[model samples]
Target: MTRSLGFGVLLALQFLTRLPVPVQCPWNADTSRWAVRCYPLVGLLLGGILALTGRLLEGWLPTPMLALLLLSLWVALTGGLHLDGLMDVADALGSNASLERRWAIMKDPHVGSFGIIALVFLLVWKGTLLLALLESGVSLAVLVAVLALGRFGAVALLVLSPAARPEGMAWAWKQHLGHRDLLLALWPLPLCFWLLPGGMVLFAALVPFLLLYGLAMIRAFKGINGDIVGAAIEGGELWLLLVAWIWWSSAMG
Candidate 1:
């Protein structure tokens, strides 16, 4: 069981981030399920790196530059996989076309004007939020929780929602996942609560956002897909950052 869990973490790092995982794990339903459960761990790893970077550069660089650098590192770590999904979903939803047409738009290799605009807006907002959080002296624990919860939201979508298509990465991940898998995904929650001051509030806030976003995706595409799941990760991060900024501001003031 320990070996399987280790392989699962490695597989998740390989699949979700640009991190080097030198071993090849055989892909099967069990391995896939393990990978799904470890998604939040991948997010925690990313958050750790970002938090370390921020701490090291805190006094040396201007807050704006540091925020931009952190944002760039965040994207680099994930190879912009979730950003691509965000852009695709933006293009598809902006088209206001039929469901079939929107799906086709998502598959198109070329990004549309809407996609470009959405990308710009998301980056700008995230960067701004990062700047605010940093300026207010955000805690490393908050940073880690923000990222872990964002990916946890992805796991939630993967397990709870039906896939838009029968064959895709999201569908494959969902295939072997059951309600029991959600308990495994909750592994990071206690750590988050222990680390952050108002962790329960953060978790409470995330649930409604996911529910509304999941429902919206279902309404938009009839079911969720890899793109939808990716979009959720991106959106969840943004929302969590916003919440953290607000919470920190109120506390500091």
Candidate 2:
């Protein structure tokens, strides 16, 4: 049981980040499915790293430059995986094409103009929000909480969402994710309350919005896939950062 859970964490790190998960574990559908349960763990670890970076560089660099550097580190850590999904989803949605055509566009190796613009806007928005939060004296813990919850959102989507295709990583994950797995995933929920300022209330409000967002993505794509899941994770992270800043600003005022 211990080994299984350890592999789950390993698989999650391997899948979600560019980190070298040096130890090889038994690879199978079961492990792949179980790995989703640890997605938030990976997010928390990533958040911790970012939080440390913020703390170490506090007052050492200009706000804008610090935010930019953190954003770059974020992209580098995740290998731009979710950002790629965000861009693909944007391009597909922008095409105004049929579902089949949209899917093809997402699968295409080349990025479109819409993808480029969307990526730019997302990065800029996140950087600006980070700058605002740092300037407002918000703790790095808030950022960590946001990152953790963002990945938790992804795991929730996986458990709740139907698969768009019978093949590929999404389907493989879906096949293994059960109600029990979902329960296991929720173990990290307490981290939100411990890490954020108004986390409980904000989390309560965020639930419906996340549900609605998931529904919209499913409606737009006809079903959820790996790309949609990634997009949701990225969107949720940015949304939390924005919400945190607003909450912090109002509180300070």
Candidate 3:
């Protein structure tokens, strides 16, 4: 069970950050689905790593360039996992065909108009939020907490989501996650949330934020499948970015 929990934690970490964690076997069928489902946590880790790294580099370089360098590293580290999802989902969502057509398009390795546009927007938004957080002089702990909680919000989608495809890892792990897993999975969130002194209000807001995103994603998945699930990770990241920005704005006001 140590291996399974470790894998799960890594999966969470993978979804939460951009840092590379060792993979025993990557791209194999046995571990592939676990890897994919756990990807959002990779973004969370990216945020935290960037948060720490950004602080270290503060006053050492141009803030935007510093943020960009760290941000680029994150994209490279996770192999742009969620960005691909965002692209695929954008392509599928913009199409007018039936569910099967959407799924077929998502599987193609080609990029499309919608996907390109989506990537541009999401990256811009994420970068903007990071720069703002830094400019606001937000504590590094708050930055890390935002990163972690954003991911916890993303995974909450899996808890509430239904699998969109029968052949993929998402489907394989659909029933694998349950309330028991949720209780265990969610354990780290509170401490992360508590990292900000009065951050509880913002933390509570993630519940509805998660619910809206999760349920809307389920509807999309029922039509779109795994590509959209990947898309949901980016969507979750975007949501977190927005929330952090709003909170920072309010805090500054």
Candidate 4:
């Protein structure tokens, strides 16, 4: 019980989506481990912020500009945190060599041609979806719902995956991913139904997207180590971004 609350607070503080209450844990024990566990919850909280931001700015700017700004907001709020991982992951997968070579590329911390292309396409994909969602008159629900689920998606990975590393934060989380892990992970799923009136239709649609996403990341994980957690988060976000964009984009035009 204490661990869960502590995990939740660490997430709120780090993600800084401006939640109402303080995101403080019970004394910051094992901060790094907690950070990994709470990482996905950040996306869920951002869902509310995303909706509020959208509502506040609706009709105040053009859809494209608003979309761009919305994404910019996330970049600033998270301190360009996951986007960097997205780039690294892209660079890793961007390689056509063996798994060992891809892992080497991911750790370089240098951007390559493939990294640049993937990052741009993902940002555009996310921004375009936001614009389309706002334009489609479903901005509030879709933004909030998708953001929430995307985060949940990350947590799901935590519950399902074993730490690829032996002594790092990911390893620590592996120790904690016992029965209680399911409690934190499953609680967020139902929230989607409330946020999106489309209900299970939206949920059903996300499954295949997630499946393909998981498969793609498996190849990357096989190459790199557990550092791919960061990459997985960004991948989940991008997947949702594309899903939302395609749905609302089709509706708008």
- Across residues 22-115, which tens digit of lDDT does each residue of candidate 3 receive? 7753333334334434443443455567667877888998878876776686577557876897898788768867877977788879999998
lDDT of predicted model 2: 0.85
lDDT scores of the candidates, listed in order: 0.89, 0.85, 0.63, 0.63
Clash count per candidate: 0, 0, 17, 0
Per-candidate TM-scores read 0.97, 0.96, 0.82, 0.80
Per-residue lDDT tens digits of candidate 1, residues 1-253? 7777888888999988998889989887777888889988888889889988998988899999999999999999999999999999999999999999999999998999999998999999999999998888878677788889999999999988989889888988888999889889889677777877787777888999999999999999988989889989999999988998888789899
lDDT for model 1 comes to 0.89
Which candidate comes out best when scored by lDDT? Answer: 1
Q: What are the clashing pairs of model 1?
A: none
Candidate 4 lDDT, tens digit per residue, 190-228?
676676666355556656765666666665564223446
For candidate 2, write residues 1-253 as lDDT tens digits: 6677889899999999999989887877667766888887888889989999989998899988999999999899999999989899999999999999999999987999999998999999999999998899988888678877888888888888888888767777888787778778767768857877577655665587679988898898867888888988888888888888888888998
1 against 2, candidate with superior lDDT: 1
Clashes of 1: 0
Span of ten consecutive residues with least summed lDDT in model 3: 25-34
TM-score for predicted model 3 compared with the true structure:
0.82
How displaced is residue 157 in candidate 3, in Å?
Answer: 1.9
Ranking 3 against 4 by TM-score, winner? 3
